[model samples]
Target: MATDRRDRTPTADPPATDDEHAAHLERSRRVWDRWSDWYGTSESDFEPIREAAIDRLDLQRGDRVLEIGCGPGVNFERVRRDIGAEGELVAVDYSPGMLENARARIEAHGWENVRVLRADATTVEFDDPFDVALATLSLSVMPDIRRAAETVYRSLVPGGRIAVVDIRSFPSGPARVLNPLVRRFLRWYANWNPDGGVVDALATVFDECEVVDTHMAGTSYTVVCEKRDAG
Candidate 1:
């Protein structure tokens, strides 16, 4: 299996300071911008898993779909296609390069129903709730994982569905014995990851949640949450 390079980077001191957050976003944009053209192409190596994540949306025509941290709009097109002419698809991400790449693809695909925007997942507003929402592999990088999950929970309709998948942090038996040293190193290189607290946090918002799938190595997991109907 391919290891996520992002996980190996030490979380910066103080986790994510204001200045550090700004620099993090800037660095992300620069890094993505450099890979814009090949952003969603097969050479990217994430295309297959990306498609799988989109498939979890189970979109229907006329449905309202929102994608948070939509990198290069890889899965946006898939959702748009599923929505057909009557539905709406909105994609958001903080990285300018990601938005640019996503916009280009939306145009190339002639998907007028799809809209891409540059916005922070931690705090973004939508005109109305959506029928389905997806935050594939993106929420894991958020600086405020809890607030972001709340935002996502709030963005859904009364009985909407949310699919989230990402790499979470866990301690290895040997690594645990190593003490704070390992955690100290991780705290410096990584940002607020969704894969860690989402399972528990989501339980508070959604009526019921289930871990739908997981990588054999336990490095990543996918979960589905449903918003139950009102009383």
Candidate 2:
């Protein structure tokens, strides 16, 4: 097995200040904007696994759900179906190109309940507390996972749930050899940090957190967390 990079290397941390983070966000937005067409929102083979991640939320009718980094709104319909007409869906993404696609999807479906907002996940001011949230393959790309996690936790109602499906470093077995390639590909493709603390940050902020499971050939892990009831 390969040695743990955590033990031998100290990679630079993400932007710590709001300005730096904003710049980082702009860079990501530009990247996505330029490539949004190539990275279309069409369905894929991983749809089932992604749906499984949403399933972890156990959405109910009339629930208010938030989707962070909701690229192109591919999951919008799936979520709206669960939430029904009474429920509201707020999907946020920084990329204007992506938001355009999302808005198109919403209009095409005539999903009056689904709303798209163009804002950064870490700083977006949510007008209301959400009942459930889902972040699919999006948290790892965030400039600051801890800040993003804090924002998500703060936006949820007491006892509200969140399901995050993200990539994690393949730590064991023969797959360890593929870590370097995987890391490079993900970084180039989306600036994703597979070694990031998305789960750890959420676990620290949420009262109850669990790794629901790993999917996509063990390349992704789904974490479910619940905000504690108000004291």
Candidate 3:
């Protein structure tokens, strides 16, 4: 675990109006709907990173888990395997097409303990807290990464954990040479900067944020973190 010592306060964009935010969400949903079926086709290489991030979540039997942006339920099998039948899974995403695909996957597997909800992860509220949370390839595409991260922080119980796997556009040392190409490609491919201070935002929201792994010339990474316990 490589500790992040950068400034905890990542720069924030000005708040968007309600209509602007809604339009943003709608646009993102449409893009995801278009990409949902094909997302895994091009992303097969990331399987190991995703697996490692899931492992860092430190899942346990009967633990309740929250998966933000649970795109097409790609993670359900492994996560369910970790938590078992006694556990509960609540996965949320804003795209109906993606959720439909997820539902189909759920039905195919006949997973009884999993629930899928279509909602904006940034604003969705829950009455029950989660033991562990996951956000893989999701936060960087969000309109407000900090707000979404804070929401995840609030959704967790004291001492809960979260694992995130996504692009790391900014890297120091010799890897920094790829920064320009990385950011450009992300914007062109995803219409957003996916790794924009995401680890920093998580650091601000959680007690600890560690870069557990980096891949692809240091262009992407996995982050694992733990929320501080409230005694």
Q: Largest lDDT belongs to which candidate?
A: 3
Clashes of each: 9, 0, 1
**TM-score list, all predictions:** 0.75, 0.88, 0.89
lDDT for residue 91 in candidate 1, whole number 0-100: 85
Candidates' C-alpha lDDT = 0.69, 0.80, 0.83
lDDT of 3 by residue, 1-231 (tens): 645424355556665678867877877887888888887686577788899889888789999999998989889999999999999999999888889999998999999999999988779999999999999888887777888888898999998989998876656677677778877777656656454478777886677788888887766888888877562
- The CA root-mean-square deviation of candidate 3, after full C-alpha superposition on the true structure, stands at 2.7
Question: What order do candidates take by TM-score, descending?
Answer: 3, 2, 1
| lDDT score for candidate 3 against the true structure | 0.83
Which residue runs of candidate 2 sit more than 4 Å off their true CA positions?
1-15
Error of 3 at 146 (Å): 0.6
Least accurate 10 contiguous residues by lDDT in model 2: 1-10
Q: After superposition, how far is residue 102 of candidate 2 from its true place, in Å?
A: 0.3
